[model samples]
Every structure is written in structure tokens, then in C-alpha cells.
Target chain A: MTAVTLSEARPARLRVDGRLGQFALLVPALALVTIFFALPAIYMLRMSFNAHEGGQSYSEAWTFANYLRLLTEPIYLFSLGKTFLLALVTAAVTVVFAYIFALYLWLQRGWHKLVFLAIALCPLLISEISIIFGWWMFFPNNGVLSITLLQLGLIEDKISLMYTVFAAIVGLTYISLPFGIFILLSIFDGIDRRVLEAASDLGAPPLKTFAEVLFPLTRSGIVVAFSQAFVWTIGTYATPIALGPDSLWTIGLEIYQQMNTWRDWPFASALAMVLILLVLGSMALTRRLTGRDVTHHV
Target chain B: MVWPFSQSDLFRWLHAALVTLIVLFIAVPVAVTAVMSFNDASLIRFPIRAWSLRWYLDFFSSSQWTQALRNSLEIAAYTTLVSTVFGTIAAYAFTRLRFPLKGAFYFLVMLPLFMPGIVLGLGIAIAFGGVELFGLQLYGGKALVVVAHCLWAMPLTFMVMEATFKTFDERLVEAAYDLGGGPVRTFFEVTLPMVSTGVISGALFSFVISLNEFVMALFLTTRDTQTLPVLMWLSLRSAGTPRLAVAAVVLAAAVFLSLVLVMLWYARHVRKLR
Candidate 1:
């Protein structure tokens, strides 16, 4: 009777442990995301409606003044447009370059492949500040680009590209390029090389082969890469502020200025809400567009 | 063929030229910055008239810079520890367990990774920025930054470990359980040993993510608790100097050093098993 009771109690304990153990494992991660991630986002949403009293951080009052002001302000409107354009341009440029480079990376082997892989990983691994510094040193009057052009007798006077729209785009593109490459490369790796060989054997030109075979094959990947770059570029404040001219205002910069410089939490939270909306919209769009293709492919 | 070239040859030429340009665009700036760190001069001039480790020495010797570095490492260390332990367990549950709302849990875990750092930073700063727990102010503390960093680090670790565990053999786990070993013993002695690579990789990933992250840190940190990247961002805005380049190099070095150490340890571990 003791033996039977012991065996029955042991199984029941194990059954209880199984369910409890799973919850215990999941609880820490769940609590973290809820407290730090989800709660903060909800708080920001609520904070956006608060009024910033004069000479005060904020006072408890419900109003749409922050959002209304963001929409009505001409400077804010311009920044909204500029930020969208900058992100769009960055994403487009990054995807094109990344597609070509990823194709090149895929074709290499052995140590050659390793070298290319390292190059692609550098921008991803290095801090965004460091990348900005690298380019900051390259674009200024006394920087590498000017010096190189001068030594090459390409120009009589040194030209500074620092704090320009062009510089900002270059910096943004450089940083986002690696992500595009890595994403598309992984997709490209999935396709069989024999398909390409078959195309060439059928008397198709390289351009034709790419257009008909490679493009369609990697369409989902391209969309994913483009959206990734866009999302990343939109959220970025440092790259544009550090590398671009004063005229090159982005929503991210506006958010920073509102929060730190103006000491206006309500306005800052409003801008942040807009940024989050844009990111979410893009993500939703990507999911809708790629959902079918991804499922079909998988 | 049109214009004295076959289409394939033309494509090859264009591809080669583009590849070269892209490679240079990616590599040259970092290379220049690394070289500039060794410049003896104060300004960020390219054709260096002198070469010295003055900036490197300056970076290490300066109280503000050294303090920031210490803060970064300390925060990253804590972030790695918390993220790895929790992330691995969560990932194990994801792969091995059958529970309700499993898909929702996975989605919730990954949501933070996709959110903008600015949004995450601002939200946390506003929400818990001033909150005190047990008589300790949470604002401007390393603990806040660790939590913020874990938003990204934890998810990343979970994603990686989930993939690792997906490929893991359940039979090994079954064998351990069938033996006299209990659940806790089986997990520690059997499961953890098998997925050691994933655990190590996830730890390294979180470490690096936390080390380099500054967007969130910028919102959360006071001057005293500022990480190196945050300090660098502030200083870079105010001035241009070889010291900044030294900071970049130092950051890169930290990443490489850990990677090398991990590789060495992994190699030794494998040899011992052999």
C-alpha cells in the first residue's frame, strides 16, 4: 500500500511540475517585455495627450494640442516630408547596392567568401556613432575625400560635403547596406544555381536571366530588405543630425530636440507616436504583401 | 553582340566595378578612422604629419571616457547575464513545450526587437524614468539601461536559441529523463551541454548588442552613468578630434577581443572533450 501511494504521488508531482516549469521559464521574459516594452509604449501614448504647461515639464490635462500642432506647424510638416523622403531614398539606394553586392558575395568561395562576409558584417557590428565618425572624417574639407581628390588633381580647391543632404544619404545608405545584403544573400542562397545555369544554356542574356529568374525569385526578399531599411532609417536621428546639414531635419531629430532641448515631453511623445505609427504601418504592409509569398515559398 | 561586348561580359564588368566601389565604400572609412586614431595631431586631418598613440592614451587616461567605458561594460555584462539565462529558458519552452497561446508568446517576445530604439528609450524613460523601488531611484541607473538593452538583447537571444533548439535532438533529453536523473539534473547535465554553442553565441550576441547600443542609453543615462557610445555621440556633436577615432577603435577592439576569447575557450573546451 505504501509503494502504490508513492508511485501515484510521484507521477502527480511530475505532472504538476511540467505545467509549472513551462510557466516559470516564460514568466521572466514575459514580465520584462510587459514592464519595459509594452507598458512604456502605452505610457508614451497616454503622455502624448498631456499638456506641457509653461515653465513646467508637464501638467495633467487631456488635449489633442500636441498632435494638432504637429500636423499644423509648417516646420513640422516639412520635417515630416523630408524624413519620409530621406528614408525612402536611403531604402531604395541600399536595396539596389545590396542586391548587387549580395549576388557578388554569393558567387565567391573559400577565403574570398570570408573576406566579403567580413566586409558586410563591419557596418552591422560597428556602432552607428563610429560609422558616422568614419564618414565624418571622410567628407570634411580636410577629410579623406577632399585630400584624395586634391592629390589626384581633380579639383583646385577643397570641397566640404559635411553637413549636407548628400552626406546624410551616403551615411544612411552605408549603414543600411549591410542589412540589405545579409537579408537578400540568405534568400539568394536558397535558390539552386542550376536554375541560373539552365537559363544561360537556353540562350538568355545575363540581364534577361536576372530579370526573369533572379528578380522573381527574390521579390519577397527585396520587399523585406526594403522595408527593413526604411524602418531603420526612419527611426534614426543620429546619422542625419551628425552627417547631414541643418536643413536635413527628420522626425527623429525633431523628437530629440523636443525631448532634450525644448524639455517638452508631451510634444516629444506625440512625435514618437507618429514614428511608431510609420514603423508599424510599414511592418503591417510588409506582412500583408509578403505573407502570401513567404507562405507559398516555404 | 552590341558595342563590341557580349551581354555576359558587359554584366561581368559592371558587376566587378560595382562590387569594387561598394567594398571600398564600406571598408575605406573604417580603415581611415583606424589610422586616424594613431595620429599624433589633435585635429581630424587625413595626411598626418606625425604618428603617435596620443589619442589612444588620451581616451584611456581621461576620467569621463574611462568612466563611460566602465559603465558600458558593466551594463553589457549584466544585460548578457539576464538575457541569456531567461532567453535560453524561454527558447527551450518555445521548442519543447506545448502550451496555449504559444504563438502569441513568440510574437510578444519578438515585438520589441522590431520597435524603434528612440521609441523604446523614450517610453521607458517616461514610464519608469522616475520610479523608485525599495528606496532606490530607478532613473539614471545602470539597472534601467540593462532593462532597456534586454528589450533587444533578450529577443535576439531567444530567436537564436529557438532556432538552435529546433534543430536539437529530443531523444537525448528523453534518455536523460529515462535514467535516474530528475528534470533539473537532466536539464543541467544533458540539455545545457548539448546546446552550449547556442547558449554561448546568444550570450555573445547580447553582450555586443548592449555594448554598442546608445539610442536608448541616451534617453536613460545621466552624465555619471553615460555609456561610451553616448559620451561619444555627445562629444562628436561638440567637437571633432582623433580622440573620437580612438573611441571607435576601442569599441571595435572590445568586440573583437571578446570574440577571440570565446573562440579560444571554445577550442580548448572541444580539445578537452576529445
Candidate 2:
């Protein structure tokens, strides 16, 4: 990780005495996370090793059977691939669109900017279930899309677009696009508007200026946005099930099925460990992508 | 891939068209949901045959829906309270006090933000399944849901409040101290008011997050303690009804209410604080 990335989230330092008092004050937050966050995670990791017998709870006969199964199991392995693929596609689409939106936002000094901001931020504020429900009404038979298309004479017959991978992609992209927009907008805010003007002044047209002067500067920032979106998208549990078909299973669904339905805690822990490792790896990649960008902190 | 339309009317027209298209794509589904909430149809289909208050009436009269709503409110209230207090104290430490291992603590505190909700939920469920505290088993209840929510809410609170305190003036604090006011008194009189907007904003965010959060709530709550989002998710998986649409509107309404509160605060308090 680079210092630039850290500085974005870092708190400003204030000089004061009584470091002891400060440490004392931090105890409640520390203890809150330690007991509820750290300890439970450790216990989960430990339970992944506990022996399982197709039971709801495992006994304390430490073994690597769950890990071995997670490695050798075809269902688990395939779900991991499917999850990574969907997440990559979703993140890529989200970042591309968000880049355009962010660029437009950076160029504008009008009410259009407020409209864009308000529209982009709505997804972040609403519940994920609500979003899934919205799209649920959107793609299914006689839903809004079909009704609108039918009324417009765009299609001869009423059609349902539900329970498809396309719906899954749309839902995932919708949820992720806001984060991408915010990240890339932060980068756009750092860019000097004069650079584009200079390119135009040098006899380059708009397309040439954008291609030569804008894309390269924003590429690493897009990488950070993409990585963050990918990491976030892979952890989604309800979107696919609610919007996509049953066959469109991801590892997130697998985790829920194992713990909630199948009652297999040990295997669920193994799956969760893999998930945590993947998220951390992607986060590290995000840090590395922006490591050398001088404009990163800005 | 730059287009050659730079000199043509097509360029500007297409740009405007594309922007409008994306806006509709983002807006239409939500509009459909809000419209469906009022649909009198038996199902969640569009082109409403007629509009009625039937679903809304059904939603209001149902004990299950009311119970879920109450549960959501209580859990969110608890989460907001606990997360805000701890997060504010932690923010003070991070912004105003120097200590060893502060960086490590920061990472540890923020680590849960990235942890998948399922993992967080599963971990707590397993670790605390057998927990006995003061002759009570702390599993599968509103209290567990509150604690689990803190994993997400506390870090959010800390991040926002920490940033807010950086803009706070230390001269005022020094002035209070110079006047012979002690730490607690200074904190209440001088420090608290300066950071009051941050506190309110953080608390509102925590509340909204808890209110809308269903991922961890999925694994944490029992049938009796299930939050509105959790109930909505459960119903969405099984029954795709307009009643669920009504529930979504309710949940979205809660968020909008808080959003209005924040906007009001921004108009009244935030500019003054600056």
C-alpha cells in the first residue's frame, strides 16, 4: 500500500498530552470491534477446521477436511469462477459508464451537474432489497418494460426479460456504478480543466484531445474504481437470486445456502475464508494500481 | 475510440441523448417500484389496471408487516446509539490524541467495512451461538443484530467524524482550558457544539444503514426479530407481491425522511458551523 492511498482515509493529527487518556478513550471502539468483529472472525477460522459429519454444528476435532473439500469440490470451485467473472464484467461496465458520467460532471457548471449527482446517489441510499424489488417489477412478464414496449409498439408480443444473466448484470451494475462514479469523480476533481483547453489550443479536436490528453491521466484511477467495484460486487448475496435465474448461482449464494439452508457451518466458514482472501487481494491490487500516480492523493 | 462526429451536429445531439438515456435507465426502475406500490393488481405487473389503497391498507393492517417495521426501528435505534457513541470517542482519539499503534488500530477498526456481511453474520452466529452473558444467551435477537450492525456503522461513523474534527478549531478548546474549564466541561461546552453537526450526521447515517441493511440482518435476526429489509428479502425470494412493493416504499421513505433531516440540518446548522 502507498502513502497516498492511506492519506485519503487518514485522520489529521492534533498535538495533545495524555496519550494514555486517548488510548483509554479508544478502548470502547477497540473492544467493540475486537469482541464482535475480530474474535468472531478468529472463531470462524477455527471452526473451519473443526470436524464435520454432515451436521448443523461441528465438533472440536480439528481437521482440514473442510478446506480440502472446498479445494476439491467442483461446485465450490465453479461458483468461485462464476462469481469472479460476473464481478469483473459488472465492474468493467460500471467503471466505463461512470468514467463518462464523471467526465461530463467535471465539464459542467450547471443544474445538469446537480441532476446527475442526485440521480447517481439514489442507488446508494436505497436498500438492496428495494433495488432488487424494483428490477423485479421491471423485467418480469407484464412488468414495466413489457408494458412500455407493448404500448409503444416496439414489440409485437409481451415479453419477459426476467430470470436471465442480463438481469443479473444490470442489477449488479446498478448497485456498483455509484461507488465507481464517486471514486472516479474524486479523480476528476483533481484534474486541471486547463489541460483539455491546452489540447484544444494546440489544434487538436475534441476527440483527439480526449484520446491523447484525458484517457491516460484517468486510467489508473479507473483501475482503482474497477478493483473496488469488483471486490464489492463479489460479496453480493440477494441480487442474483432475486433478479436472475436460479442457475445463475455465485459463491455468495453458496455461502448463504450452506449456512442458512443446509446448516453446514464448517463448509460455510471455508467458503468465507476464500472470500475474505479474495477481497483482501483485490484491495491490495487497488492500492498498487494507484501507488505511483502522483495525483492519487489529490 | 474517438468518433469522427466532432464537426457534425451528431456529436452534441448524441451526447445529450446518451445522457438522457442513462438517466432514464437509472430512474425508471425506481419509478416503477414507487408506482407499483399503489397498484391494485393482485401482482406486481405494470400498466396498472386500476389504482387503489388496497395494498397500502393491507400493509398497514397486517401484524407481520407492523412487527417487522417496529423491529427495524428498534434495531436501527440501538445500532445508531451504540455505534455513534463508540465511533465519536474513537474519532476523538484518532484526530486529537497521539498514541502508539494508532495505525494498526485504525486498520483493525476499519477492517470490518470490507468483511462480507455474510461472513460477519456467520462468524457472529457461530461464535456467539453458545454465548451466555448475565444468564442470558445472546444469540438470534435484536441485540445481536445491533452488535453486528456496529461492525459496519462504527467505522463509517469514525471515518466521517474524524474528517469533521480535522476542520475543528483547537483555539476554542484552548480558550476554554485557559478559562479554567476542565476536560469534560470543555468537551461539552466547546468541543461538542463544534462537532455537533458531525455527530448528528454520523448518527443519521448509522441509523439509515441499520434500517436498510439486510445482509447481516439475514443471518442475525430470528423470525420475531427480523428487520423490515430482512423480511422483504425473505418475501422477495418466495413471493413477488405488491405488498413487498409497499414494504420497499416504506423502507425507502425512512431513508428519504433522514435525507430531508440532513438537508434541513445543512441549511440550518452546517453553514453556521463553518
Docking class of predicted structure 2? medium
Worst 10 residues of 2 chain A by lDDT: A8-17
Interface RMSD of each: 4.0, 3.8
Query: Candidate 1 on A1-298: residue-level lDDT in tens?
Result: 9999976786688768866886788889999999998888888888999999898878888999999999998999999999999999999999999998998887777898899998898887788889998999999898899999999999999989999999999999988898899889989889887777778778788778888988999998999899889988998889998889888888888888888888899999999999989988887788897773221121
lDDT of 1 at B88: 96
lDDT of 2 by residue, B129-164 (tens): 888889976887789999999999998888888888
| DockQ for each numbered candidate | 0.53, 0.50
lDDT of 1 by residue, B163-252 (tens): 899999988976775566788888899989888989998999899989999999998999999999999999988997899999999999
TM-score of chain A of each: 0.93, 0.89
Show where candidate 2 strays beyond 4 Å.
Answer: A1-17, A54-56, A292-298, B1-10, B270-274
lDDT of 1 at A49: 95
User: What do the candidate models score in CA lDDT, each in turn?
Assistant: 0.87, 0.82
